[model samples]
Target: MPRPRYLLALAGLLFAGLAAALASAPRDAGSQVFSPRAVVPMVARDEGAPPPPPATPTPFAPTATPTPRPPTATPTAAQPTPTPRPPTATPTPAPSGLRLQGVNWYVNTTGTIYVMGIVVNGLSTPVELVRINVRFYNASGQLLATDTTYADVSIIPAGGSSPFWTLLLNPPPGVASVEAVLGTYSVSSRPPITGLTPTVTNIYRSSSIALRVVGTVRNDSSATYQFTRVIAAYVDSAGYVIRIETDYLEPSTLAPGQQGTFEAIFFNAPAGLETNNLLIWTTASR
Candidate 1:
């Protein structure tokens, strides 16, 4: 059963051609035709034969898988946070013990009864919005009419006093007596006004004419004021208030370090009104 020698030679040539084709082709590791485990056999050699060339080391090395790490924040210097300012609140004050300091009433040319007075803050705390109540009586001690009036000053410090004026334009016939009393008020949280400094520079008063008072008020406070209300009164030599007149400064609003002027006029002047005994006062408001 010996095969033909020519057939054997042809098969050997076919195998040699395939080996040459594989040696000349390009290699793509991603999609190779041959298995990675395949290897060529070394040729047989005698003990005396020279040892085969030392195996060449591969230049390609397996790369290590990177270990993931948590992201680190850059170091930054700490900054201080400013605290917000709290809102200011107006609180109710303790009970205000107010007392009437000076009170006077008069009848003008129009038969209008004018009741004016001063309220003294008897408490140790500041008070605001002081008011006055006036009650009139006839000759028979009957109630004629009544009215309430607010103080010209909006705030009064402890032991300080403010003036109030009320009008009874229509009084019952035979109104003989009147009583001025203290009314409502509030305790204030703000400090008492000490910036309004009223200085009387001129005055005119006579028994036959109306009374006039001129003054200037300086804003000694560091804050601006929207109003500088001025009030004045003519006092007799016996210390009784003859008349009270209220006025506002010409330039009502006053900035810090500025001053304002005012003219107070009281018509139907009464006797014993003295220029030397004028009581001029002022209070600044926001």
Candidate 2:
């Protein structure tokens, strides 16, 4: 019986030791698992902190730029002006026929009188006077009286003529002088004769290389002759008149039995023997 009691005591002691060891091992294993899970959760919280400070937002930059433009043009300056030209002058005309030659004023025994002398140059054609007007003026340059008359007066058929009585005026008061005018008022104008016959003589050549011709003009009519101009024709050895020489006769007057000598010259003449014939014509007053 003693041995059986000793065996039961040993089995009881071993069961108690095994139960205590199993209980302590379970407590240490649960502590190691819980520590590793808490450490992992703490590391995750530290890694995701504040989302990295919101990434620190940067400023926006510009893309592309444009180019600049150029300036505009300016205007120019002005120019100068031009000058004007001058005008031309006119010429005067020559006087016609039937002009007043002279005037005379005198006081007679009857009353204050005026006398005037009239002249008409003879023409190549016959000229007839149809009217004559006489005007009297006083010393104060006032018109005293005017006398108008008409008559059939025949002028010599020649170029130049003498003084002829065509008008006579007698007025009263302070009469200074009388002006007499004679013209072809009612007569028709005659055609001028260009050609005439002349007698030539005494022909020679001068030292100045000019051909001198002297001629005596003969009157073709019974009335007094007045020579105006002389034209000479120069003839060569072939009997052909090649050139002409003209001479204007001023103060030309001729009587019934009187003749005038006319001289003419030619600058150009042939070396052969030559002859000259003259032609005389007239321009007279009516």
Candidate 3:
């Protein structure tokens, strides 16, 4: 026994409930799916931008300033130069007082000519080492030969004379005249050695080759006289020199007031001579 109206009402309520449930249900799975880009982060970039500068630190302490220095001075005046000097000169000696006198010549048969002359010292001092020059000439005044000779007297006193002789071995032709010249002379400034005398004895012609003369010399001076020399000269009747000879005293020295004997020989004498004259002279050291 159920009623019909109740049945129909129950059917209507069921259909209405079904329709609300269908409208209120969840959506489909295909419509809820997501994209890959939506989960990551992103940034935006600009076109023109300037870079930032590096940072600098500040100083801790203060700085100090530097000081200047002064300048030095220079000198102006310089040193002076020195000067040079000149040299000096020396002087020379003057000529002496001496002269020549009486030149003579003689010829023998053997063509040997003998030349003789005299030297005179006019100065206040004595003359030593006298040299004489003999020049031979012809009748036409042309020079033939020139000869030199020394006086046998080593020292001639003031205002005194000394004899000189030379032998020409072989003379040239036309020798008619001769001239004597004073070649050289030396005067002593020292004091004179005086008081010497010579004596001739035993005089003879020993053959024709020689004339022998023996003599003695005496020294009358106060001082000792050394190296005394004695000379002798022979002349013919015509007053021309024929021969000359020299000799030295023995011991070669004479003390105060001493005498010594000597002998001399002259060679080449002419034969048969009629008359002859002899002269003697003496010299000694100072």
Candidate 4:
């Protein structure tokens, strides 16, 4: 039992190279070990086979599961903002009737300020567009001038009355007192814009026109009037209204019994104006 000597010459040189590779193999080369060119031996395999069975695993070609990659237009975090729409509102208008009755104020001699008025249709119907607002104060109160006037009667007949005036000329240096109210009015059931009918006798005075008026407008109803306004109010001796005028009737149309003629001149009359303390009105329209 003694073996050594290079392991007995390496087992006789691996038994003479496996008998010279079974005498140059082939005769069914041991069934080519499941041939296919003897399963690739590339000229000289120096003994390689087991590693080949692993290659048959290529049947696991299941790599097609990559289709789930579609939601990426650049966004990996932070996203949430969408909500805005709300704004559209406008509706306001509702207020009518309430104060302005016989207010008065006068000042003249160059500062000229008169806020005369009279609007009284104390309900029971009939009233029409009676705007008239005046302000102008300053006796330690502030606010100095603002005037708007209207209401020379276009329809006031329920107790009837209408006449308004407003004027302010260069006043605002502590102009002292004034505040006539009522602005914007309405309560009409029609009828009373009449067909014109006014008459203010004829009066005169002039030292450069300090009051003078003459009027006529007459188209007594049957409808056929037009424009024709002739307002006029010039009282004093304490009735306030020191000259309010609006004239125009040289032919402001009138035809159902025609008659028209108007001429007025009142250069701020005040101090004792008496042509019967005047007040005339006329308005037309069919």
Candidate 5:
């Protein structure tokens, strides 16, 4: 029991305190559990809303996109280089037994062309049956005609030379050059005739148409010769054979220690011939 003024003061103080407490209270009503029955209504409503669609999780988190890497260069296989080869050298031809000495080309009377030349047996061994070929050419180095001839002597002695003559029956017009070559040659290993002594004399040109060679050959070997043949070679100043001739002795056979006289005559001997030589040999028995 208070006086009226005291009561008014007390009421005023209470109201002020109530207003301050209301202002300081929490704004979220969920922070305070008024009763356990309040949770039941909230849970019932959440079940009706389909549990908020299982929290609707985001698919992925946002992040900076990875920078693209530059394209890698592909490796290439290496190729092998080929090595170059050097050029091969050419070989030279081998030398032969006979060699060319000289060549002469002349247009004879009656419009017949002639090729005359000489060949030598450069080897130490004797070469026989040497055939020669002459090629005629024009001024333009083209082949015009060809001719063939045999050596003057039957057999060319070692280090000896022989002459060859080719008569072109119908030479091409304007023949200007000539080339003579030793076409072929044969070498004989046969045993040479021995023990025949030959004496040569009276070497002279007869009537300007024949060459006369007078000789005496004696069979000094043990074997008797059935046939004796005398061979003569007309030689030039250079010791090359110009012409060759053959002669046979009378009675054909000669006993050992028997002698015979032979007269060899050469027709159409060339003018440049200066000397003569004789060779006596017997043929082998059949």
Candidate 6:
């Protein structure tokens, strides 16, 4: 009996010792109980963080420079003007010499007379004649008649000439001889007429108190001619010297082999004059 009670007390002691060791040992798992009235704060911190550095401000730089420009120029003006031109002038000419050579005279019993001649000298070149003067004289040196004639006469050409003739008739009583003189005023160088023969045709006086006369004259010249102051004279039955009328004839231009006729009509003459006693006279230009 005693042994069994002793063993039971040892077992109870061993079991209490074991229970105290277990309460003091390290445990892998544990449980805890929290009260509702208790407050707990939890703060989270990052591990291994770097410290913050201080701040610094940056500085400003300078600006660039501009370039310079050049200058410009100006303009100018103009001037004035002038005028134009004109024209020129000219001149005049001169005169010339004589163209005639000679004169001739003839008479008839019926109171008819004739004069003939030719142009013997002149310019070798052709020219014109403008005027002529002539005079007639009788045997007593008495002036029977005077005349002025005009015509265009050509000069003796290089190898040629012109001929001229005139007629006169019916002389004053006691006048037996007759003469003729000629003058040429203007002439140029040209051919003239040569070798002309003249003939007197008739002479008569009108039967009137005034004793007017009529006569015929001719030109046998080869070239043209002109005559002025043609006249006729006569003696009347009363022994009075009678002077008849005068007039101008057509300008006479005689071509080769041409003939011209001239008539003289007179005024202021003596009365009862015989026709057979009448005489005519003329001067011509060549």
Q: Tens digits of per-residue lDDT for model 1 on 1-286?
A: 5579989998999999999999999864322211111111112212111113336998986689788897698558877989999989989764446766446566666777666666667678888877666677765667778788877777888978787777888777766666666656777889877877888887776446567778889998888888677888765554445578888897999998998999888777654354436777778777
* Model 3 lDDT tens row, 76-176: 77658667667676676432356554445566567776667556666677867777777777767788898888766777888776888887888998776
Residue 175 alpha-carbon offset, candidate 4, angstroms: 2.3
**TM-score against native, each model:** 0.63, 0.28, 0.56, 0.31, 0.43, 0.28
Evaluated with TM-score, which candidate comes out highest? 1
| Candidate 4 wrongly placed segments (more than 4 Å) | 1-106, 109-113, 116-133, 139-150, 154-163, 166-173, 176-184, 197-205, 223-229, 233-243, 246-286
Per-residue alpha-carbon lDDT of candidate 4 for residues 38-78, written as tens digits (9 for 90 to 100): 11111211111111111334455775676677766878898
lDDT minimum window of 10 residues, candidate 2: 34-43
Candidate 6: deviation at residue 264, Å? 23
* 10 residues in a row with least lDDT, candidate 5: 38-47
Give candidate 6 misplaced runs (Cα > 4 Å).
1-102, 130-132, 148-160, 188-286
Cα lDDT tens digits, model 6, 70-159, are 556443555454554564555542222223432333343355443333333333454334333445554455666654444322344432
Question: What is the Cα-based TM-score of model 2?
Answer: 0.28
Best-performing candidate as measured by lDDT = 1
Deviation of model 3 at 212, angstroms = 1.5
Superposed Cα deviation of residue 142, candidate 6 (Å): 2.2
Alpha-carbon lDDT, every model: 0.69, 0.43, 0.65, 0.63, 0.58, 0.40
True-vs-predicted CA distance for residue 8, candidate 4, Å: 99
Summing lDDT over every window of 10 consecutive residues in candidate 3, give the lowest-scoring window. Answer: 37-46
lDDT (Cα, 0-100) at 179 in candidate 5 = 65
lDDT of prediction 2: 0.43
On the 0 to 100 scale, the lDDT of residue 182 in model 1 is 61
Q: What is the lDDT of residue 251 in candidate 5?
A: 48
Name the runs in model 1 displaced over 4 angstroms. Answer: 1-96, 205-207
